[model samples]
Every structure is written in structure tokens, then in C-alpha cells.
Target: MGRKNAGIKTVCENRKARHDYFIHETYEAGIALQGTEVKSLRAGRANLKDSYASIQNGEIFVENLHISPYDQGNIFNHDPLRRRKLLMHKAEIVKLFAKTREKGFTLVPLKIYFKQGRAKMEIALASGKHNYDKRQDLHEKAAKREIERALKDRQRY
Candidate 1:
């Protein structure tokens, strides 16, 4: 059966996260945002390039997340790079805590989107990739592209 709430509107995505880390699992968590922050997110004025999530004192918080201030908010605008709390179940938090404690594992924000009028973040359990791994991935991608180009040229002839 199809999902009941499938109309997710993506606000921002961290494409570099996939390239820099090996993502193991993903979880959806709600964000605690202020009024102006919500308005700015709705306008798609957000960046997740260098954002990351961390568990602190039994609660999860996202840091370095940039939700630009609302243009019309005047002095009531929220800080662009303020830390925000993330809402997840207690059981889920415990599980994440255990996993993140392992060596080289971390919580990374993959994307931020609106689901059924509420903003949610897609966070992943990831481990950083080595420099050689990144080079290998780029080489493979280039080889795949060259193969596709050759096939297309042969078909044209």
C-alpha cells in the first residue's frame, strides 16, 4: 500500500553529505523552530551544506543549520545559524545514542522538508569516507559517463 502522507515538500538538501560519508541509516525528526524561522523555511531560504546533528544531555540538537531570517520580520527575526532542538521518540533517541557512540559514526542531516504542514529533517547515521574512497567514486562515475556516451554515439551511427 502507498504511504498515507507522501506529499513531502523538500526545502533544502545536503548533497555533499552523500559524497563525504557512508550513510548507514536515516531517521525523520521534527524541528523546534521559531515563527520567523518557519516563515523563512517556507520561502526555501535555508542551507544544510555544513549542518549536523548531535545528542547532548539526552536531547538531540542540530547545529550550524542556517535558516535565513524572514525579510519582513524586522527586529523579530531569528538568528540564521542558531542551534535548534530535534524531536524524536525516547526509544529512538536511546538507539541513536548507542550507535553514535561507536567509533567513526556520527549524525548528519541529509535533508530538510515539510511533511503535512510540519517541518522534518532527514538525519543519517554516517561514517566519513577516506580520501581514496572519494577518488574511486569519482573515477567510477567518470567511467560510467564515458560508457553511456559511447553507447549513445553508436546508436546515433
Candidate 2:
């Protein structure tokens, strides 16, 4: 099947990232992973909830990401929480760095998925959301649910 339609064996997800941050932009970047790490990720044992990205020297790297070791791998197995490098074009990296340097902007990984047999990360440039904003979002969601229910009931009559 196509990459978009491929069966999702999700490696990790950052659920709270969207609730706590207002995402401004998103970019897809390839991840540098060892063979064992890739195997472990394919088994859906990765964690992205506590992960974040950082720039050092001139390269970008993902930190705090946990990729559980393959239970069957030998001494060559990879570390679960090792800092992995993200591969993006020079221009893209520069743009990301500039935007994330702003007061509240941060580099957050939203999800990890495999495409064309390669691992990829969906990263977002986001700003922290205030308590009031979160409350307002919840209220809007409730309102939308009410409207949808009313429409469905009317259609059934």
C-alpha cells in the first residue's frame, strides 16, 4: 500500500503536547536510528511524551526520547533513551532554530511514524498555552458536540 495508507505501527505519541502548546508550524524530519532501535520501534515500544529537540553547534538533535531495546538483540543493542539526531535540510534547520529561539516557541515532537520504510518525526513549532486558552478550547469542543447532536437528532425525525 501507499505510505499514507500503510498500516500504522505507531512508535510514540505526545498527547499532552497539543493540549499544553499552541502549534504554529509543523515539519517532518527523518530520524537517525540504529537497527535495533528501529526494530524496537516497529514493535510499538517507543515513548515521545517527555521528548524535546535542541540545537547544538550547528545540528539538531532530539532529546529525552525513549526507544526501548529489542528484547532479542545482542550486545549491539541501542540505548533506550539516547539522544538521536534528526535529519532535515540546512535551510529547514535554520528556520526551525530561528523560530524556536523566540520567547515562547519550542520544538516539540508530535508523533513518530514510519514512511517508505523509514522512521520520521512530526515536529511542531509551538508556544505554551495559557490556562484560560485551554478552558476556552474545552468550552468550544463542548459547544460543537452539542451542535452535532442536535443536527443528528433533527435528521432522524
Candidate 3:
């Protein structure tokens, strides 16, 4: 039988990133991973929390991304918090760098997943959300939940 759910398998997601930033654009970039790192990722041991992308010396790199070491790896385990290079087109890098230079705009990794056996990261160009903006989003979400609850109750009756 064919493998079930053979599409993209998500390894980890940064939920906090969504709550903290207003994402304007997203880009898919390949990660330069070591052998142990790839093994650990395939085992679903990775975290995107507090991880962010930045332009450094004309290249893009992700920092603070924690990829747990492979349990079976003896002496070649990669560092959990090493800065990893992200592979993207030169033009895309230039655009992203320009946007990040603007006040309050930053680059954050939204998620990490595997596609066609290759690891990929979804990075977004985003702006920080103000406290009031966060509160407003929460209020709107609660309102939508309430409306949905009311509709379900009406159908039940």
C-alpha cells in the first residue's frame, strides 16, 4: 500500500511568531543541515520558538533555532543552536534585506517542514504588532468564536 499522508510533513511551527508579528510576505528557503541535524529533524525534534532570520554579510542565516541532537549520533552531533545558512536566490535576499532595514520590520521563521525528502523553512517578512493591536486581534478572535458557538446552538435547537 502507498504511504498514508505522503505530502509535506511539518516538523515544527512557531505559533508565538504569528501572535507577535504581522506577516507581510513569506519565502521558502532551504536549510543547510548537517547529517545529525537532518536525522534529528526527521525524528521530529526541532523548535522554531524564538528563532529568527537575518541578513549577514550579504547572506541570510537563521539564529536561535534549536535542533536537538540525534540520539544515536555518537561523536558527530551538531550544535543545537548554531546559526544555519538559508539558501535563497540573490534577488530574493536583496529584497528581504531591504525590507528588514525598515523600522520595525524583521524576518522570522514561521515553520519548518519536509517536502520531497528535503527540509525547508518558511520565513516571513513581518512587522512587530503593538500591544493594542494584539489585544484587538484577541478580541476579534473571541467574537468570532462566540458567533460560531451561537450558530451551533441554534442548529442544535
Candidate 4:
């Protein structure tokens, strides 16, 4: 049997978020999008790279999320790089705000997807990874790949 999220469809992912940060927690957030923005997202014209979330005045907003303008929107097309609000509970916002105030802790969007026709974003509470830490992770990944290859070869022979 295969595990499938029947109604969820991924739109975009920030692949570098994992390599650059140590993720501590993840939150599913609803994006407050305009009509053109939602249409653009449905067309798969969104980018999560270089985007991060910030808490301001008791509200959470995402910056640098680029959702291209809808082709047919013409006069009413929304700005591609405008900050978008994230919908989450007030208690959760307070928690995230506190955590982000700590040294090196930040909110990074991991991926954006649609669930049952509504756009959603998966954001993470993360801390930055140092150069050495990144190098160590790469080395470990290489080692695991080599070990897997050796095991497969052994079984084949």
C-alpha cells in the first residue's frame, strides 16, 4: 500500500532551507492571498526560495514569497513580491514570536502546497547551520550513499 495525501498537492518547496538550517518544529499556515495570487499558485508560478516569516504587531507575515501575476489578470494583477499574511492561532503566534526572539532562531518556510483547494505553507522553527555543520552533513550523506551501494553490490554478488 502507498501512503498518499489524497487532497494535498505540492506547489513549491524551498530545498535550501533544510541544508542551511536545523529545523526544530514545523507549522502548517494558511496564506492570505488575493485572487490573482491564488490563480498564480494554481498555475504553479510560486517561489519559496529566499522567503522567511516574521511576526509584526501580533501578526505573522511572510516576505520574499514570489507568486507571479496571473496572465489574464491584466489591470488587477497583484504584486509578485508583496508580503503576505499567514493565518495561525494567536497562541501559536505568541509561541513562535518568543522562539524567534532567541538567538539564531528563525522562521523559514519549508514548502507551499494546496490542500482541498486552499493554499497552505509549511513553515519551520529553525536555527542557522554553521559552515562546518553543513560540511559534516554532506559528509554523512556521502557515507550513507556509499554504504547503501556496498550493501546492494554484496547482495547482488
Which one wins on TM-score?
A: 4
lDDT of 2 by residue, 28-108 (tens): 999999889988888999889789999887799999999988999989898899999999999999988888788999999
Candidate 3 structure quality by residue, lDDT tens digits, 82-154: 9999999999999999999999999999999998899999999999999999999999999999999999999
Evaluate residue 84 in candidate 1 and report its C-alpha lDDT on the 0 to 100 scale.
100
Score candidate 4 by TM-score against the native. Answer: 0.96
Candidate with better TM-score, 1 vs 2: 1
Q: Tell me the TM-score of each prediction against the true structure.
A: 0.93, 0.92, 0.95, 0.96
Each model's total of backbone clashes: 0, 0, 0, 0
Off by over 4 Å in 3: 1-6
Model 3: worst 10 consecutive residues (lDDT sum): 1-10
Could you give the C-alpha RMSD of every candidate to the true structure, in order shown? 1.9, 1.9, 2.4, 1.4
What root-mean-square deviation over C-alphas does model 1 reach?
Answer: 1.9
Candidate 1 per-residue lDDT over residues 67-134, each given as its tens digit: 99899999899889999999999899999999999999999999999998999999999999999999
Clash pairs, candidate 2, are none
Query: Is 2 or 4 the stronger prediction by lDDT?
Result: 4
Point out where model 4 deviates above 4 Å. Answer: 1-4
lDDT by residue for model 4 (1-157), tens:
5558978999999999999999999999999999889889999999998999999999999999999999999999999999999999999999999999999999999999999999999999999999999999999999999999999999997
lDDT, model 1, position 15: 96
Which has the higher TM-score value, candidate number 2 or candidate number 3?
3
Between candidates 2 and 3, name the one with more favorable lDDT.
3
Each model's lDDT: 0.95, 0.90, 0.95, 0.96
Model 3 scores a C-alpha lDDT of 0.95
lDDT value for candidate 4? 0.96
